[model samples]
Target chain A: MKLSKSEVEHVAKLARLELSAEEADRLTTHLNGIMAHFEKLQQLDTEGVAPTSHVIPMQNVFREDVTGPCLTAEEALANAPESSDGYFVVPQIVEV
Target chain B: MTEYEPVIGIEVHAELLTNSKMFCSCPVEFGGEPNTRTCPVCLGLPGSLPVPNRRAIEFVIRASLALNCEVKEYSDFYRKNYFYPDLPKNYQISQYDNPIGRNGWIDITVDGTVKRIGIRRVHIEEDAGKLIHASVGNESLVDYNRGGLALMEIVTEADIRSAEEAREYLVNLRAILTYIGVTNGKMEEGTLRCEPNISVRPKGTEKFGTKTELKNLNSFRAVYRGVEYEVKRQVEALQSGGRIIQETRRWDDDRGITIAMRTKEMEQEYRYFPDPDLVPMNFSAGLIEEQRSLLPELPQARKERFMKEFDLSAADAEMLTSTRAMADYYEEAVGAYPDYKGISNWIMGDFTRMLNSAGIEIDASKVKPVDLAGLLKMIADNVISGKMAKTVFEEMFNTGASPKEIVKSRGMVQVSSETELYPIIDQVISENPRIVQDFLGGKEKSFGFLVGQIMKYTQGRGNPQAVNQLLRKRLSETKG
Candidate 1:
């Protein structure tokens, strides 16, 4: 399926991405090409094949609830642009 | 105005008391120095993978079984995508479809009628960081210590009809969760959080009005008041020919009203999908039965057992079984002493008052069950009068001392012997000649006055029964 300009913009917005008009157009063509490849594969689907997220049969991977180690506050915030009072400071949020 | 009914469904997010974080080994704790518990995995640094916590999953399973839910055989984890600074990762690891537990119910008695509120699902997820806004700044502070803590979200169906019912349902739900050793279920400390979505429908109408979700319900009273205020606000809006908008509302505790939040509900969309980093958990029959067997007798069953075993009334059994520690305390104390009803009276009356005033629970109490039974034994053994035990108990509560020690240190033993009490009784008889004369003249109430004087003279340590019999003998001899 071909994605319209608005659909491309909506996807970018959901991803919090800012795309210029030229960038949107170029991505749209690339996305359509990827969709065409999927369409060709869609025609070759076997009826009895099961859908899967992983190739191998793997489940129930777990870790014991024992605590090990944690980074100091300074080390944790080492890469952040700003921090104060042992906290990561950000602009006042507008969240629901 | 047309009559309307308010519909409410509550959602609870309780932090699991795991020793470590959900996907990492960082310690999970509350109220530590900011950012002290962060790691590469929880802080969302690149190239770090998450392994699920076995104990955390078992905690959720325990709670689900206690709530009478059907534990699913297959469960998958998903990432709920959103934009929030508190979330180090933009998407929170959650369970979107095929939650671990579903279709459960808990019974709450509101207005003397038992009703089963439906539990839609109980899913596990990670908690976001805490945000504290500076009073005068344009920035907010975030503490990641609470981040990545395992949280279990229990969503209830729209079965509540009033604010009171909503409060009762939460009370009953918290009891069950805390009883099964899953979470602390502390709302004030923010370990347990409740959000109620409310809507109002006009009488005889088949459609529901637009609903609003409420936030900042930190206590049961707040839940009651917040829901009550929202119901009234919606009913008033409909009565004024104004339509309610579907949005999130903040409960303004100071102003005591629900104000619409600035964020538009339409803008908040969580596109959920299965997280590729984590694998799905397929429960075996043995595994599910293991969790189910770990489940203890829940609050309801224990309450019934208490009534039959302890021979307690409905209210007494309910109060005793309010918390697991409390019920255990009662049973242990009764085991020490066979006076069941007498122990119940002390726990429900003076013990609870002392605990409430001290702002502690039975588990944190300084007075142990054996200590209380010891205090009662002092009275039964005639070492101290019932009246003298009150003073001894106050000292015991403050110092956690033994009843014998308190009585000894305070010099408050009961004077039961004739040799010890005869002098004080004689002194009272002579000092109150008017009362003695009144008794001789057939004023029967005058004898009670004489007994009071002797008790007052003895500093309330007089054995009341012994003092009564001796004073009667002395007064009759005076008449002869």
Candidate 2:
């Protein structure tokens, strides 16, 4: 369960984070230490135990199908970094 | 040449027909002003929590039951982490380990043989926003109106062996979904979409070759063509002693070729974990029973029933049951007039043509179900000739007028009575003496010519059967 430096770099690239060489090495060690601590719990015999997804026992928390109020165009675009003509603008996505 | 077989599996995404978004109260609509449907929960703002839509879950359960899938008593939603501009949250809330439904099967008829395509799983997820790229400038815009919408992903096993089978499978699946009122299944509007993963393997080999994922197939025809191109490309590469590479491909529809987008090595690892904000779904036996009762007669079942109940041919039944609205229209018309074949002929023939040319659905057409039945009754009662009925139908379709009104106003009544047609027949006989001589001289084709003349004289309103009988009696009388 040890994390490799390359694995950490790959994860950082996927997250769109520009990590330096020093940060990558340090993060790898930190992640490995966390994984090693988690590995200690694997020694316990926990067969037939269901994996819990949520801490709360609540299920089927939902709202009705009816629509309520929505944000106006100006309000929605207020926090956007860049906008034009009632839309969020971003860099061009190269077609594949 | 070496023998190769193509293996294909299709994954389809259909937007659920709900009033609101999947986790937010923004209206789930198709087209609107950009950013008008945004909300904090959908925009993934800090401190905003997601609450699932009840009707969307019910829809998924109903769809699962329709597809003969096993509904799990407990299913949890996971956050599939990814980075995309259209994804506001940078992670899509989807089901991974425990999907809502699994192990279902759909039957598709390929070349007259019913082949059951295995359904791997059906899960619910939130849709990303739309990205619109400008042509003149190097800029892209995002419309969050479609963000956080409920979408159901239906994945099928690699059971399809040909492009035709894939096409049929999609067609049948769309029909079933539309029949259950879960999704509109409109592929043109991007509400419904399909992506096929295709690979080639040696004939009689159990192992599958490297498969490519195809995207941007907008229609069923595109699906068929894309799979065909991919299968051919793979087979050619194998024949040339080249190894197939797993990649994502885009269908170049205009060129009819699949272009590689990215290889599998570039595939992102979607770290999926349960969403902490939303709770898992739990269904009781009573709830499952209630959802099952909500299932309407699906397309396949209704198609079979149509064949048995209406005594329709397989092709006719398939055409009539193509869409739920069309099927309902057919049934209502049949109720008004029990002549099953007669109603089938009109709907499958004239009504369908009108609908196609006018670019409208049967329910949206001016001619209602009762109107079609009434027009068919006129043909049955000899009030109008079949040829004349076509004209009347055109008029009725354009004006939304009833059949009786159109017939009376246009003076298109059939001249079926003996007394009314006798004089006209006599005039035609005298004027076309050569045709009469030919008829008496045993030129049997002249009889048809004479009938055509009478119909022409009566402005295409002559009862053809009555005209045929009267012409024969007069010809015999002249001989005697």
Q: What is the DockQ of each candidate?
A: 0.70, 0.80
Write candidate 2's Cα lDDT for B1-480 as tens digits.
789999999999999999999998999876779999999999999999999999999999988888899998998899999877899899999999999899999998987999999999999999999998888687899999999999999999999999999999999999999988999888878889999999999999999889989999988899999999999999999999998888889999999998987443348789899999889889988988899998888888889999999999998899889899999999999999888999999888887898889978788899888888998999999999889899999988898999999999988899999999999898888899888899899999999999989889888888999999998898888878
lDDT (Cα, tens digit) per residue for candidate 1, span B332-433 = 999999788989999999989999899898889888899899889888888898889888888888888989888888898899889989999899988989
* Deviation in Å, model 2, residue B414 alpha carbon: 1.1
True interface contacts retained by model 2: 0.92
Worst 10 residues of 1 chain B by lDDT: B260-269
Q: What stretches of model 1 exceed 4 Å from their correct place?
A: A44-50, A94-96, B264-266, B435-449, B472-480
In order, the Cα lDDT scores of the candidates are 0.90, 0.91
lDDT of 1 at B460: 89
> What pairs collide in candidate 2?
none
Candidate 1, overall lDDT? 0.90
Per-residue lDDT of model 1, residues A21-73, tens digit only: 99999999989898899989989958998666555578999999999989999
Once model 2 is optimally superposed onto the true structure by TM-score, how far is the C-alpha of residue B104 displaced, in angstroms? 0.8
* Alpha-carbon deviation at B283 in model 2, angstroms: 0.8
- Which candidate number maximizes DockQ? 2
